[model samples]
Target: MRIAYLTIDNINDNVILAQTFPLLGRLATLPEVDGIDLFALRKHGGDRYRAYLPPTRIRVRVGNNHGIWHPLTWLHLVRFALQAWARTRAGAVLIGRNPISLLCLSLAASRRGTRLVLDYRGLLSEEYVLQGKIARRGRMHRLLRRLERWAIRRADAILCVSERLRERTVRWQPVAAGKIVVIPCCYDPRVAGRDEATIERLRGELALDPARDFVLAYAGSLSVWNRPEAIREVFHAFRQIHARTRLLLLTGDLEAAQASFGDEAAIIIRSIPHEEIQHHLALADLGLLLRDRSSVNRVASPVKFAEYLACGVPVLVTPGVGDCPDIVRREGVGYLLDADLPLSRIVSEIRANRSDFRARCREVATRYFDGDAYRALYGELVGGKAFRRLPESPSVGKACA
Candidate 1:
């Protein structure tokens, strides 16, 4: 069957490349898929996505996304819908959570008996509200929630990034629970570990003090949702215990990072290529995946969580923020650090299990980040595993369960 997959994220953005593109590649490469037409809301980087598109079987279209509340944004989605109706006779529609896309695809799917799939990473309205971009009771927020409800009910299948997120989506349509599939933002196994030589080379290039510094790195966008103050607090706390520890920020939002940490005791980096991030992560003894425990963050499956694990870097994560903490605890690969953990205990945990954590963390990452995990889950969601035959490993199911 031909599938028309759409993401609300910018196609060429580092975020999409990390999570969405790998899955898109998996789907497009399948023999049963005659072709897959991918639609995106924006294009941040030039020519990054072009090399990945298989010219014959996969086609892509991206639209304007200048402002979130802009009327033109809605018009752009409508235009994408129109384009989809005109250019593709798809049997299945897979969409990332964008209300306008949902509204348009509902109409498009109804006419063609197209299977509708919702990739509900997090509730869009809740994300905005938690980030202080919108009021929970405001007209736009309520309207988007209404649209989200409609989309949830209309979708033939649903994919949630976390199990908690799936439970949250059930509040919208309890009957649709049967169709929901848990597929977290996964990591690419190819870049799982970096050689010490390469890591040391990069350390020199980036002017990092390889011998003295214990890099505590955070990679991904520095959004309004992130607690930069909290990051600093934790870094300082960790540093007080382990004097060699240094905060490393690898982010696209340099301005925001600077504003929060202006020439402070941290190493700031511009957004590097997604493929190169794993190598940089290898330099970090601990990776940071700290976020506020709001409704949105509680359900988020941060891609960086898996990326860190893939690079054999243990994480210092906040509690009750989706599956990461549980995975960390179960695997003994990371620390679920409280804001007030004592310095002595913190230092002991780090110094004692450093080697064991590195080995086990990579093992746990292999189980969670395998692309086939999502491929199998998607196949189950769409009612068949016949579409793609990637080898199924039992370890992932065990790890996630």
Candidate 2:
């Protein structure tokens, strides 16, 4: 069946959506499927706008972006939705993080008898609340939450990035249980394969002492909620334990993080292209996933975790947030430290079992987080009979929560 994937964000620029786009590319390879169309919104010169398909045969459309701050952006988005409805004979429309797109697509799908699939990346309203950008009980927060609930209720299928998020969505809107599906953000090993020379070049350029220093790496947005403070604490602990240890932070906000960390024992590199991530991961000895146990962080499925695993790197994670720790512990891929654990104890664990941890990292990715399994899962969600039935309780929510 023909499917149209819609998102407000530029698909090429969005990290998560870009990773998912390849998965859709794979789905289009299936025998029963006709083709997949990707419609992304792009900003135009001044207020003028237009729509055009991507050069790739995947049938991509770049709809006019009414500058994010423009008062008429929503109206323009509605117009784009109507145009998409008129142009494609899609059986379903998969809507991404854009709520305005969700509302418009839902309406269009209803009119065309096309199914609407809502891919909820995160609880955007809750994220604002945790960031202190919006108060929980504020009128704007309430209004946004109402709209989120409406989208959840209207969706023919709801895909969440993590099980915790699926559970939370249902708790917030009970009717969501009937439609919600958890398709955790994952790593594909194909994405992990990098040229050996490129990998070596990056390691040499970074002056990474792979044989001597134990590289402790963290890659992603160096934002406030990620608890850069805790990461600094871990680096401090790493310094005390091993003289040959160094912390590497790969982020888009390297300049800001360098200012934030001051003279900390960490090397901060500004963001690298997605194609080069495997090389950076290959040069690293260990991975770090540290986030504060805030409401916004609790249900996150940070894409970095999968990237780390794909590179066969061991991870050290903070407990009680995301499924990373559970995946680490259950798969024996890495260590999970309690938030309240003594820094000395954390350091000791890392020093004591470093070898086994690295081996486990490779094993876990092959055995549990296999890319083939992920592909099969996506295929089932899109084509199998189970798509209509509610997923089993254990399969649809957080393991710990």
Candidate lDDT (C-alpha), each: 0.72, 0.66
lDDT for each residue of candidate 1 in 22-87, tens digit (9 for 90 to 100): 777777656566677777877367667775553356778888787667788778777777776665
Residue 114 lDDT in candidate 1: 66
- The sequence of per-residue lDDT tens digits that candidate 2 reaches over residues 1-401 is 66667777654443534355655656676666677766666663321211112223477666565665466766667776776677555455455454556876664575564667777777777877876767898996897788888888887667777777877888888887766656666665454576889878877877776556777888877666787788878777777777767777777676777776776545545577555677788777778988777777778877778778878787788775666777776676777876575655645665577667656676666554444554544554455335433333233332221
Clashing pairs in 1: none
Best model number under TM-score: 1
State residue 28's C-alpha deviation in candidate 1, in Å. Answer: 1.7
Candidate topping lDDT: 1
Worst 10 residues of 1 by lDDT: 392-401
Whole-structure CA lDDT of model 2? 0.66
Q: Which ranges in model 1 have alpha carbons more than 4 Å from their true place?
A: 52-56, 88-90, 131-133, 205-212, 265-270, 383-401
Residue pairs with colliding backbones in model 2 are none
